[model samples]
Target: MSTPFDLAATDELLSTTRAVRKRLDLERPVDVEVLLECIDLAQQAPTGGNRQGWRFVVVTDAEQRQLIADTYRRVSQSYFASRAATPTDDQTGRVRSSSDYLRDNLERVPAMVIPCQQGRPESLPLAAMASYFGSIIPATWSMMLALRARGLGSVYTTLHLVDDGEQVVAEALGIPDGWTQTALIPVAYTIGTDFKPAKRPPVTQIVGVDGW
Candidate 1:
C-alpha cells in the first residue's frame, strides 16, 4: 500500500474524472471484479424511499454489443438528423459534430452498462422529480470516478434510447420488464490517464443565491 497521502488523491480524482470518448481503449479487456467494485460503491448512493431499486445491466458479449450499438446508432442518427446547427460558437459546433461521430461509431465500443431505476407505479409528483433523480445520479458519478481511478473511461449517453428501440434492446438483453432505462455507459480501459477538466462556465454563474 503506497499510502503517503489519500484525500489529496481523492480530491484530484473527483476533479479530473473526465467524460472520455475517443480515448477509450477498446482493445484492452476490463476485469469483471473492477467493474463490480465500482458497482458496489454505486449501490451506496441514495435511492427514492431508501428503496435501492436501481438495476445495472452489463453487456459484454460481442453479438449483444453489436445489437446495442446498432440500436444506439439508429436512434442517435434520427435525433441528430432533427437538430439544426447554428455555427454561433466554436464549442457548440464542435460538440454537435463530435456527437455525430460518436453515434456513428458507437458499435465499436467494447462494453455497455445500462443503469435503470425501479419503475414506480404512478407518475411521481412534479416536486419530487429532483429528489427522485438525485438518488441515482450520485451513484452513477461514483461509478465513473471509480472507473477513472482504475484506468478506465466511460461516457454517459442517452441518445441511444431513440429509434434504437430501448425496449426491444432491453428484451434482447434479458433486462426485466420494469427496469426503466435511465442512461447508458460504454466502458473500456482508457489509452491514457492524462485527462484534464473540461472547459465550462464559472460555477458562480450557474449557482444562485438562496432565492432566485
Candidate 2:
C-alpha cells in the first residue's frame, strides 16, 4: 500500500519545523496576505464544539510593535536575570542566548501575531482550562507549521502575557475584554531554510505502554 501524502516530505516538514529565533530575517518584509493564508489554513484545525473562536491580532505598525517589544523586555528582564544567576548546561545556555537575542530584536521582526481565544480561563477547572487552551493551541501550531511551509519562521513567546503584561498589551492593541491571548509569535523570513531536526531522547524512553 502507498501513503496518501508524500511521507518523506511530511516527515521532513514535521521534524524540521523548529522554534526559530535569532535566525529570523529582520530586514526582509513579509506579506500580510501570506499571514492571512496561513491563518486560513490554521482555521481548519478542530475547535471545541466547532466554535472556532480563535482570533489573530497581527502587529505591523511601528509604534505597536515597539510597545509590545518593550513590554516583553520588561517582563523578561527578571527571567533572564534569574537564568543568568543560575547554572545551566551548554544547550540551555545556548537557548537562553538565542532567546535573549530575540527579546532584544523582537520589534524589528516583520510582524507579530497574538493568537487569542474568546474566553478567559482564569478560574476554570482543570478540564475546562484544558478545553479552553486545547481550542487555540492546535490552531496556533497549525499556523506555525503553515508559516514554516511558506519559508517563514516564527517563535512562540509568552513572556509578555505574564501578570499585568497581558492587560497592558491588550490595552495597547485595543483587544476587548473576555478574550485571552495565548502567545506572542514574532514572524519573519528565515535567514536560511536549512534547519535540521533537533536531538531528542529515544521514543521508548518517554512513551509509556498503557500506564506510566
Candidate 3:
C-alpha cells in the first residue's frame, strides 16, 4: 500500500508530542499568529453533531497570567500535599516534581491557553457529560499536536478549574456564563526539540479485544 504522507515523520510527530513542563522555555515568546494558526488547525477536529463550540482564551498579559498562576498554585497546594502523603512509582514521582516546577513558574510562561466549550455539563447524565466534553477534548489535543509541530511545548493542567477557581478565572478573563473551561495549557518554545517517546506498556497489556 502506498501512503500519501511520510509515515516516519508522522509517527515521530505523534509519538514525540509530549506533555512538556520543566523544559518549556519561559523566556521565549510564542507569536499570536502561530497560536491562531494552531487553533485554526484544531478547529478541523471532529465535534459532536458538528457543533464546533470550542473557544480558546489565550492569556499573554503578565498581570492576568500572574492571577491565574496564583490561583493554580493555591489550588495545587492541597493536591500536592495529598500526593505527598501517598506513595508513588518513580515515573509518578518524576511527574509530580515537574508539576511542582510548573506550578511555581506558570506565570512566567509565554502564554496560557484556556480551552473552553459553550455549554455547561453540571448535573447532566453521564452520557450527556461525556458528549459535552467529547466535543472539546479532541480539539484541544489537536491544538497541542499543532503546537508541538511548530516547536512550541505545552502541558494541559486542570488544577485551576477546581471548586471556585473556575469562577475566579472566569472573572479575571471575562469569560461569560455557560462556557466550561476544559483545561489550562501553558505555551512556550522548548529548550530543544529532541523529544523522544515515553515508556509505556505494550499494546497487549493495555488493549482489550472486544472485552476487558
Candidate 4:
C-alpha cells in the first residue's frame, strides 16, 4: 500500500536515503516496531516463482555485535587503507570521507541486519542466476526504502565477507546453519535529514541502441 504522504515528500525520500555513516546517531535507540514495519514493506518485493528465497538475520546483542564489529573493523581497515591510497580528487575525496566515517562508527550503530538468500548453489545456468538474484535483491532494496521512510538510515556493506565468519557469527546469534549472510547493514537514526542526491551521469549516456 502507498503511504498517505505528499508526492513531494515521497519523491524527496525516494531520492535521498543515502548510505549514512557518520551522521547515524549511534547513541540513539531504534524501536522494534520501526524495524518490523520496514521488514513488512520488504516482503512486498517480487520474488522468482514466488519462492521468496530471502531471509533476514538481525543482530542486537552487545557481545555478538561486538564480535561482528571486530570482524567488520578488520576488513574495514583494509578497505580504508586502499581508500587512503586513492588520489584525493573531488570524487575520491568524498569516498575517503565516507569510508572514514564508516570505519570509525560501524560498530556503534544500534542494529545489524543481514539479508540472506535461502540457498547457495555451487553453480547455475545464467538464466537461473538471474532468477535467483531477482528474488532477493528487490527485497533488499525494499528494506532500504522502508528504512528511509521510518526516520532511520543504513548502508549496504559487505566488508564482513572477507572474514567468512558467518557461521561463527551465526552460532553466536543462534541463526541456523543453512542461511548465508549476504550483506551487513548498520541501522540507526540519522542526526539530521538534509541529504543531497548523489551525482551521476545522465542515463542517456549509458543507454544503448538495439545494436551495440
Using Cα atoms with residue i matched to residue i, what is each candidate's TM-score against the true structure? 0.88, 0.97, 0.98, 0.88
Cα error, residue 198 of model 1, in Å, equals 1.4
Clashes of each: 0, 0, 0, 0
Better of 2 and 4 by TM-score: 2
Indicate the TM-score of model 3: 0.98
Error of 4 at 23 (Å): 0.7
Question: What is the per-residue lDDT of model 1 for residues 1-212, given as tens digits with 9 covering 90 to 100?
Answer: 58667977877897788767778787887777888989998898877678777888887888888888788876676466666543347766766766666676676777778888776423778757666677778888888888888888888888767653778788898878766777889889988788776688899988989966
* Stretches of model 4 off by over 4 angstroms after superposition: 1-6, 209-211
lDDT of 2 by residue, 1-102 (tens): 587999888888899998899899999998899999999999999988898998999989889999999999987788888888999888788888899899
Order of quality (lDDT): 3, 2, 4, 1
| Stretches of candidate 3 exceeding 4 Å from the true structure | none
Q: Which 10-residue window of candidate 4 scores lowest in summed lDDT?
A: 161-170
Displacement of residue 96 (Cα, Å) in model 2 is 0.5
lDDT of 1 at 125: 81
Q: Each candidate: what lDDT?
A: 0.78, 0.92, 0.92, 0.79
Error of 2 at 144 (Å): 0.5
